[model samples]
Target: MKTITLIRHAKSSWEYDVSDIDRPLSTRGENDANLLSKKFIEYSFAPDAIFSSPANRALTTCNIFIDNLNVSKKLLSVDEKLYDFGGHQVAKFINNLSDQYNKVMIFGHNHAFTAIANSCGSTYIDNVPTCGLVMIEFEVDYWADVKKGITKMTIFPRDLKD
Candidate 1:
């Protein structure tokens, strides 16, 4: 079996006159990242590999989760391909993932994340909000063969807000 977890980058700040890829997370984004990461730790779900978009916002959110979840920094890698907003590149990246890793986590942008989740997961999600997480489990043994799978879990910052 193979499992893929997708996380959308936290809300980014537009106040900075920087490129989209260089934009940092907003204050609310940091808080949400912290809140969600802490709550996610309770689930005790660990990924064999973690990949993130090279974009600043996505990488920052990934770092927050890694620190809070106590996941090894070694498991993390930045991939320029994950910066894709469209689902095609993201899907191709996932499909080409090494079969050695059964469970993997990815941090990236949306439209791509949401699109991929809706296409592959049994559950239909209108959107995957900032810092949102969706985990899909496939029956296939190989990553290349993963098509439709069960939506095992979803964690969103809004749901955790008190």
Candidate 2:
């Protein structure tokens, strides 16, 4: 069995006059990401590999999760292909993931993340918001054979609010 978890980047700061790829996380994003990281352990979300978009906000979010999980930096990679917002490139990249890593996590943007969750997982998600996490389970032996699987869980920042 293989599992893949998708995490949408945390809220970004528009305060800086920077390119979309260079935008940093907002204060809310930082705190929200930290909160989500604790939830990850609570949910027992320990993956074999963690991939993130090269974009700043996404990378920052991934880093926070990595830190909280105590995941080695060696297991994390920044893939430009994951920067895709259209869902096609991201989908293609996931479909071609190496078989060596059976359980994986990807930090990226939407509508790609939302689209991926809907298409690759049996559950339907209308949107994947900032700091959102969705876990999917696949019965395939290899990622290349991936198709629709089970939507095991989903956690959003709003769901944590008092």
The number of the candidate with the highest lDDT is 1
lDDT of each: 0.95, 0.93
For 1-162, candidate 2 gives per-residue lDDT tens digits of 899999999999999999999999999999999999888888766688999999999999999999998878899989999999989988888888989888999999999999999999888889999999999999999887888899999999999999
| Colliding residue pairs in candidate 2 | none
TM-score of 2: 0.98
lDDT per residue for candidate 1 within 1-162, as digits (tens), equals 999989999999999999999999999999999999999898898899999999999999999999999999999989999999999999999999999999999999999999999999999999999999999999998889988999999999989987
Top candidate on TM-score is 1
Candidate 2 segments exceeding 4 Å error: none
Query: Least lDDT summed over 10 consecutive residues: which range in candidate 2?
Result: 38-47
Per-candidate TM-scores read: 0.99, 0.98
